[model samples]
Target: MSALALLDYASVFVFALTGALVASRAQLDIVGFVFIACITAVGGGTVRDVILDRPVFWVANPNFIIVASVAAFVVFFTAHLLESRYRTILWIDALALAVAVPAGVAAAVAMESVWPIILIMGVATGCFGGLMRDVVCNEVPLVLKQGELYVTCAFAGAGAAVVLLTLGQPLPLALIGCAAVTLALRVGSMAFGWRLPVYKSRPPRV
Candidate 1:
């Protein structure tokens, strides 16, 4: 398989794992696990494709769905083996974001999109899956969290991809660089508590 295809499958697997983990944490059943897994795996790509006026990716190839379901099953059976379940979820989500960003950017680039749209699609690809996962798991989406660097990391990585591509870097190389940048930023935040400044409400003057 091509590198991009491999990246997509790997991203889907990780995202599905996180979703299944969330379902397990919520004490939901097998069906819930699969449902959440599939959504988290394909939600971002589906949104990107729709916005780009392309066919939904999973509709073109059902292997993505199968991969997601398999990931959910694996996580369901192995959840107890993971001691740091929350930490695992965070790591997997970060990796998924890193890969999905380039996957989104590739689609836009293929369509001959302008740089701005390319960047937006990249961020959307990285973030929308997690957004859907959180919503379905009854948690606030991470992207909406005040002071969180989740979406910021995605934007930086997407922008980096665009810059690299503009400089005539090969797509695979650009994707690797983009994913590394994203993963580093996110992991740094998790390890060092790096965060954006939170909004401070001021009292109105009388």
Candidate 2:
């Protein structure tokens, strides 16, 4: 497999693990866990593909499904061993976001689209699956809440990729730069408790 394809596969597996972790915490059954994992692994790619009018990548490759299923099953059976390592979960999530964001950007760039669409696709690939997973688990989506610099980091990385590509940088180098920036921003946000201000509505008049 190509380096980009390998990175995409790794990201999918990591995201699948994150989904299984959430489902297990929510006390979901095995089927539900697998369902969530599938969503988390492929949801972003599905959205991206639909928007780009391309065939969904996972549909064309059954290995993605197999990997997601196996990840869910492993996490389901071994959740207790992982329960106390929430930080590790967050780090893995950051890694997945880093890798997937660049992958999405590369896909759009390969299609010869402009920078704006590429950045949007990158952010969608990085954040949308987690957003859907959180909503399904009855929690505030992390990117929508005042927790950390989640989507912001994704955007920054994606934008970097676009800029580098526009500047005639090599594709692999551009992807690496984007992923590194994403990982740094995400990990820093978590480590330093960097959060955007919460939006507060005014009280109703009497």
Best by lDDT: 1
Residue-by-residue lDDT tens digits, candidate 1, 1-206: 87767878988998999999888989888999999999999999999999999888899989999999999999989999999887798888888898898888888887899999999999999999999999978987877866557998999999898999999999888888888888888888888888778767688644
Positional deviation of 122 in candidate 1, in angstroms?
Answer: 0.7
Q: Write the per-residue lDDT of candidate 2 for residues 17-123, one digit (tens) a residue.
A: 98888888788899988999989888887788889998888888889988988999999899888646455567777887998898788778777888899999999
The list of candidate 2 runs beyond 4 A from truth reads 83-88, 195-206
Predicted model with the maximum TM-score: 1
Worst 10 residues of 2 by lDDT: 82-91
**Predictions: Cα RMSD each:** 2.0, 2.3
